[model samples]
Target: MAKSPFRWIGRLTKPVLIACVIGFFSAFGLADRIAGFSANLGEKDRMVRWSAVLSGATRDAIPVTLIDIDPSTMAALGHPQSAPREVLAGLLSLAAAKHASGIFLDMDTSRPGSPAGDAALAAVLAAYPPDAPPLALARRLGAADQAGNTINALAEQASVLDAAVRGKPNVIWAASVSRIDEDRVVRRWQLSHTTCAPGPGATLPSPQLFAAAVASAHPRPLSDLNAFADSRTQTACAPGTAAASPPAWPRNPDQRAAIAFLIPDGPDLAAPQFITRDGRRVPLFRRMPARALMSASGAVVSPQAVADDLLRDRFVIIGASHAESLDGHLTPIGFLPGALIVANAVATAPAVLSGQPVGPLGATLIALALLGALVAITSRLRPLAAALAVAVAVLAALMALGRIFAPSTASDIVLAALGMVAFLSTIEGIHAIGKDWRARGWRALLKPEKPPAAQPTETIT
Candidate 1:
């Protein structure tokens, strides 16, 4: 029984072909269509989020906000000529008044400094106090002293972190865990991680180090604290993958397990709330008024938001989420909104408290879905149809998720819309460039005559 030649061509269409290829790559985590993830929440309808939190849109219900240094701040900071340190210090002070959960210094302090400027900022940080503190402050409990709060003392001791408050014990630093992608984009970033100390004990990334520094500020004696995650896990990851390093353990037993204990948990993890800095609100992407951010003196606030949150017992993560600034990462659904990073962090904090990780598999699945969907659209469907399908799928998926979970749909919607556009463009590009070379050749057979090439000299000679 011989098969018919035409049977070979039974099922070939743009959609199916592309979808198959896309699905295969997605399953393997190698979709290469997207440019990369972004951290910009300045775009309309986006929120920021970061990791150390659990799952994706499913867990997006959590609330963390972007204390943006927007145009308003820019104006207050004095454009290009004036000093920015004063402005930053003022913002910190203002947020403190608003009772912000905690302030994470998302900005890089390594840069932007002069002796005078650094001293000014350090003085401000030293003034604030922490909810809890080291023995130094603890010893000073009954004894009166003309110094800042416990937060200020600890922040001051965090000289490696930059500068500090002189007598305060509650200040802390915050940094990001940036990850690179195939496309050379900083798509996914981690708020914390475990790493080798490196030769000569090179320091860990800022986020983890800063977190460690903050966790150490507490009065809990190291002897009573149970630290973990520093030990190497015996388990091996999958083939070609690097082994998972253990996370840093805090000296405080409760915090040795997680940072949630660093401060008391107050608001519902998912409540949509933002800290109103200095009783003034900034446009989501813009900044608030100068007067609102400033103290009667040239200084910003009487006390930083750090003092307020810690003194009041709150959770804070002072980190930046500026996408145009390339200060963001790729998340499960795609790249996360900067605002969403804060949300993800707060959401994941519970898991850390409970010792329940959302599992790498969940994030893996999201990346796979995005990659697969893109390849499918780009390879198979018509440009217009693929685009429409992608948009619809993204919207439907986000809406569906949002209906049950809080804002869990943002990533899905964003990725889907992007993939749809990509796939459509790729398909159109392929078609527009021309295809079916075999068919074109076949048409040549119907030509009247061939333009003959010169023949070799006759061998008969």
Candidate 2:
């Protein structure tokens, strides 16, 4: 073959050899576009964030609030046997009387009336009216039967309950999204708050939303409390003789309620300690102990603080804090105390309630700039050394950013981390590919392939 003079040049230059790898990622839409890079990087960063956030066994700042019971408690309580309905009622009543700013009920009534096991739970829930603002079912029980009868029955109960709690206090429901990225970590909390019915009536709403509606429903300005009346409609979520099932309650000016917040709760959590009595301490996630007291008993927070905040017209979300009940969250520093999250809920309610938004792009650009400098400096170093430097830098950046982002409750951390990861991975992948390509070319040119005729010549000899 003609002397492949350019072959040696390709081997030494390295750029030509790495072009295939570069082109491969680019063609796959991974390394080529900013959006793609941002997304992939964002996802990986989310994983790392979760790891770092949940690394220690410490509790999360967000409380692992338990509003419902699980199988273990059920077994302990001697089920098939139920916790006295009165106990359930008393606890809720206590919370409301204590000026507990808000309450969220996390439970499912999906199979109500379907079987003996489900019917008892349904009755206890139906006893509370939706208008009372003391409770909100996290969700209607999903369809358990082929005919969807179970779902229909639960929907009716929810509707009936919704009517009773129309505008009392902030009694919100909870919802969650099931989707996740390449990693199982839930990056987004898709308001798991929605419902459909196959029965005469169906209804559903988040406890937070209900509670906000109640708070937001207080029509008067902060100063003119005496003149304030609920401007919110009193329309019940129950069926109104519509040919098809009527829509759920708080439906006005659109289906949206007055309250909505984008804060997320981790699904990667342990079950909560659903408190039925006043004195029992609720357990937190990971079987951690958290005291759960009837809000009325004033066992949890200082009365002075509670009174002051109540007077200031702040909302309070009082739920049991137990590890077994998982009333805690995994925060960056460690497990944050649940009490702090409750305080944040009230302290920043105005911003969250008002729907303040922070831009991800701004965060991304800033992070990228910082990372770019770091990458540039590290790029010249050996791979291991560079990796270590980048890792340290990332940790420092995360701690600083955690402080900045916490107050605003923004998604900036994920976006920023993603930006950093993307740039670094791209550069590293490219360099490795280039080196590999260069090595291959060097081997090809330095030790040319034996002439094909040599094989035939050996046979002839």
- List lDDT for all candidates, in order: 0.39, 0.38
Off by over 4 Å in 1: 1-62, 81-83, 97-99, 132-173, 184-187, 191-292, 295-461
Error of 1 at 127 (Å): 4.2
Q: How many residue pairs collide in each prediction? A: 49, 53
Q: How well does candidate 1 score on lDDT at residue 244?
A: 51
lDDT by residue for model 2 over 238-348, one digit each (tens)?
334334333233221122211111123434442432311123332221121112332343233333433322222223333333234344554322343343333323222
Least accurate 10 contiguous residues by lDDT in model 2: 225-234
TM-score of each: 0.40, 0.44
Where model 2 places Cα greater than 4 Å from the true spot, the runs are 1-72, 81-87, 97-101, 110-135, 141-160, 166-187, 191-356, 406-461
Report the CA-based lDDT of candidate 2 relative to the real structure.
Answer: 0.38
